[model samples]
Target: MNILITGATSGIGKELALQLTSKGHKVGLMGRRTERLQELKDEIGDIAFIRTLDVTNHEKAEEVYNSLIDEMGGMDVMILNAGIGRIQMLPPWEAESKLIEVNALAFAHGCHFAMDYFRNRESGHIVGMSSMAALLAHHRAAAYTASKHFISNYMKGYRQKAKRMNADITITEIRPGYVWTEMTERAKGMFWVAPVEKAVSQMVTGIEKRKNYVYVTKRWQLLAWVAKLVPEWVWDRL
Candidate 1:
């Protein structure tokens, strides 16, 4: 299958490109770092296509993605994996606003492009990188959590729209709890962190199965249920 993934410089996006291309799938990767993109292309060899662009630049991103789709003949799957996160200290609006831009607006850009492509073809898959934070609000990172919530709901809305239009499209929202990637490597007080490979393996399975929503590592499903079951004040205490 032809697959295009945004934010492929590192972490889950990079690993997914590696694993998928190693398995003989044609993969297209977009990232801001040219050197990193080149390195990934060298590592993955001929099956990989590399384009350097910031996902937040919606117009350029669309052009690059459309070129990738054309180069690969067509895209079977598109993964909107570009995101940013940080623990706010004070005067949080700056970080919060950036988070919303990268995590939410960038995501919408990719989703719009993919939806248009898929709708015209009548068959395709879109996989979004939401987080378990979508299920609960985080005190230190409210914007990050809120952005993920936006992603979850946005994907669900597309799911419903596709159904209404009788389009043969799949919307898969991947809500990962904690994966040990560069994004979380410096994070303190982390819990239940799964290895990148472990998380990606499960994520790939869910994508292949075209699941509407899935928690990485499976065990996170328990946490999600508990999060919903617990009362607000009780949750705050934990």
Candidate 2:
């Protein structure tokens, strides 16, 4: 598969590029960091292509994605993994709004672009990197959690759209629990945090299986089940 991954500089995105390319897949990598993307391209050699792109830059992102697809010949999957996480509300609306831009709006931009590209071809996969926070919102990370909720819900809607369109477009929503990545290295009260490589391995498996929803590390599936049983009053109190 020829796959394009946004935010491929570090964390799960970087790991996904390495792992997928190791399995003989061509990977188109995009990130804000040129040096890191170069390192990945060097490491992966002919199978890896690098583009410096900030996914929030909508116009540039579209150009970058199309350019990579042109370079790769074709793209089989688009992983919308570019996102931001905020653990506080101290700075108020500005920081929160930026989180919305990257996590929600940029994600939507990627999704819309990928859907258009795939629909024309009649077959493709779209992966969205959401979080367990999508199920259980946190007070300290209100914007971050809500943004993930948007990701998951938006993907669900697209899944339905794909069905109605009768296309072979797979929309996979990855809801992962705490994994020790650059994004969550300083996060407090973390538990059952899977290694980034391990998490991405499970994610790769899920993507290959064409699963609609994947909970990384397997144990997180139990949490997802419990979350649905929690009452609104309980969540409101938390």
If scored against the real structure, what TM-score would every candidate get?
A: 0.96, 0.97
lDDT of each residue in 106-210, candidate 2, tens digit only: 999999999999999999999999999999787888899999999999999999999987579999999999888998998889999999999999999999999
What residue runs in model 2 are displaced by over 4 Å at the alpha carbon?
Answer: 87-90
Q: Count the backbone clashes (under 3 Å) in each candidate.
A: 0, 0
Instruction: Give one digit per residue, the lDDT tens place, for model 1 in 1-238.
Output: 9999999999999999988887789999989899999999999988899899888888888889989888887899999999988845646787788889999999988998899999999999999999999998878778889999999999999999888765799999999989999989989988999999999989888988889988988999999989889899986876
Off by over 4 Å in 1: 87-91
Residue-level lDDT for 161 in candidate 1: 88
TM-score computed on alpha carbons, candidate 2: 0.97
RMSD for all candidates, in order, please: 1.5, 1.3
- What lDDT is reached at residue 51 by model 2? 93
lDDT of 1 at 112: 86
